[model samples]
Target: MTPDSPASIRPAELAGLDLLASAVVLVDSGGHIVYVNAAAENLLESSLKALARQQLAALFAMPQELEHIVAQAREHKFSDVRQELALERAGREALHVHIIASAMDRPDGAVLIELREIVQQMKQDREERLLDQSQVNKELIRNLAHEIKNPLGGIRGAAQLLEMELPPLHLTQLREYTQVIIKEADRLQTLVDRLLAPHRRPHIVGDVNIHEVLERVRSLILAEFPLGLTIRRDYDASLPEFRGDKEQLIQAVLNIAHNAAHALAARIEQGDAEIVFRTRVARQMTLAKVRYQLALDLHIIDNGPGIPSQIRDRIFYPLVSGRDGGSGLGLTLAQTFVQQHMGVIECESRPGLTDFRILLPLP
Candidate 1:
């Protein structure tokens, strides 16, 4: 619907758009900005009063395509979505956004526009993919672990019997071979146990202070890298204690911190490696499609060579690692523990920076 005049557009209707997360703007047929919502004001970094009456074309680096879309939208009385538009700002870098223009039912030929950040959209998609992939990986690992576990004990027992029967004479070689088989079987048993650990462990719920958990991990990591590594804490003291398994949380955090410390080997030897444990309360946070009033945002940041690009995307998968001689199960277990507590572990890495963020819903 097109409005014949700007005065005919309803301010109350436009004000309701502020509840949306997407930036919303209304422009008349003359391409003059008529209304801007709170999200738009925040995205544009300009107050509504300052934005009103400005030329809508001025907001975009190249407005020709947007103008054509708006014209088509107005003529067809429908909505049009365009991807990857450069939103120009006065000083800051141009933002990549998806623009949706819909013809408004008004007398002045107004068009309502919605802007969504492309990066944020990609992040949401990534999170969904991670959650889905983790489920499948966990199931596969558990089944494979069980299948390997049953045969391991039989192999170990048979090797022990063979060793006992062969040592009656000068048979050192035979005994040594049996020992190797037994040792290898035992090693396989241990690996299988670790794979099934998350499923076997019981959920021991207790009041969990996130800072306390971080402190435990910090002490353990510092003990291991006593010479050059420094662990820093940035805690939000006002955060309330939540119910979770304390031991599992400790292991989850320790795995990540330990991985970071190992990655900082070069900097640690030079006496300049640092890892920061930061915690804060997130309001109106959503996890796995479930929205919470408040959640705990914990970040484990490190100053080190970033995670290897090849394994960056699949780091949480079992047997995926970046470091030499790495078991690759640390992050898999960490993710399992966090997921048990209804949280997610997300990672971002670049040269000299690797950040692991864990988001858990708070009471």
Candidate 2:
């Protein structure tokens, strides 16, 4: 339909489509597009007007099979029929989606198709599992920290006492070894304290503007990587302030940014390191198996040699590290802080791109 056509969809109807989170595409019996919702436009990477001129077969992997399914649904007056299908889009990888097709009870015999990517379902499952594992890890680390703390104290005290008792002749060389023992024991003591800190620390809640937190981290990161790193800000100015611990949020973002900077050392040296801090309001978001009506979606992305795939799955686990000499506690601590605020952090990485996303409830 042309812009001047009276048969064109009214603005009120288009506004209704914009409210839907699911990708909804309306197709007529003759296999032509009649209407495509905002979500559908994004999923299909085409404007509604553009989609209206395209054939339905141009979007799916096996058009003939979908045509057959639609025919059976229409003949039987079936509604809410779902099928797993793949979408075929030019110059892009085919998306594996679960499609729900409902034959509208209209004379035009239109079909409403809703698409949800299968990978998103898998990621939801992974997020739930990761949260449960994080809880288990916290318990294990607490118990282990206590158990390790007592022995460390004994070793440090014994070493100090032995150092004091050493004779003058042999004291110098032996005292050096005792100093090493004391230093290592002190380091382990510090590690254990950090492992238990979150559990013991009091929660300080207040209204937090996410941008403010990002600014704090930005200043800190830029100060350290002053020469060769660029930290880009892509924040949503209209984001509402939410209640959370400002200090914890700062630490959480700082840890992730610091880790990204560490991973970008080579790129930084070559003067091409880039990190992006992005924020957006997500509607109808699900995190850790719990659905929220609205949420804060924050992404920390880096352009560096990405994380190793071998250890990618275990990156959030305590004490796991890809870089040599890394404590591997940065991400773990970051996850802990965000979890305390009823949020979740997830990572996706590959060669040349590494992204960490944080999702939290919004008012």
Candidate 3:
């Protein structure tokens, strides 16, 4: 192995890089690609063999900026970090990426380049914020539920007593007013119970088939919207089962699908409503700051008017709803359920497409 030869770094040593969620590329002093990790292949939409000996800067729209960073790393033997760089591919959309270039110890002045998608970084940051905010929101809701629960019972009892004390026949007409009060109290009580349900329910863990959960949700959704709505399935049959609460997962998915159905009301009336349930195996996925070798990527997508942008960011927060008269607990409870299983749910929406993606780690 000559000191000037980077060929001394065998493929076996680079195998570890494949496990990383971040894209990595190794460039020799001449700014030619020597090695590319699996994540890099996915990001560049090319294979390692195809990229071997290719100029690293050629893959990016701003080649001169990339080349300058690589040169600086090689000359100073220091690391350089740049943000919001565009990586262009022939048949795909340009990627906004954050690039990190660091000089390696090789005698040939080989440098290590790491690429992270800006959108993905922002998504991860949002997930972390959602998780933290959810904890505080749950606590507030639980306390509020308890407070409301006590008064609800009292209000219902008082209303019942007032009805009983009403005059026999003529005042029976006045009993209707008391009945309304009692009924509204009971309704509020039910809402309070649901607010505290997640904290009160026991997590029943067992081997769960994600497809089964999806099928159950599909049936329930179709049963409700039998005529106009269509539920499509795109299943990856190779996905493995993992430990979780099957019932909780079903309810979680059903809640999201149900919301989509309601959001698609206009299309449903026109007999064009469509909701797709897609399942795929994700490799080297990071969920809740932990990187997993494999994970389940489940998407519930609907072709509707899309979520109103005003409340899109807070959809998972308790009582935040985009639709009129919506209690807003569905997505919040779905997020709580997924979080219990160490998973996270993210959403993307536009004028015609709304997608809710749930990521769950698989053992």
Task: Output the worst ten-in-a-row residue range by lDDT, candidate 2.
Answer: 1-10
Root-mean-square deviation of each candidate, in angstroms? 3.5, 5.4, 2.6
Q: Give the winner by TM-score.
A: 3
Candidate 1 lDDT over 290-350, as tens digits, reads 7676899999999999998898989999999888888889999999999888888899999
What digit string (tens of lDDT, one per residue) describes model 2 on residues 66-90? 7876776666556577889899878
lDDT: the better of candidates 2 and 3: 3
Which candidate do you rate higher for TM-score, 1 or 3? 3
TM-score of predicted structure 3: 0.89
lDDT of model 2 at residue 237?
Answer: 98
Count of clashes, each model: 11, 0, 0
* TM-score head-to-head 1 vs 2, winner: 1
lDDT of 1: 0.87
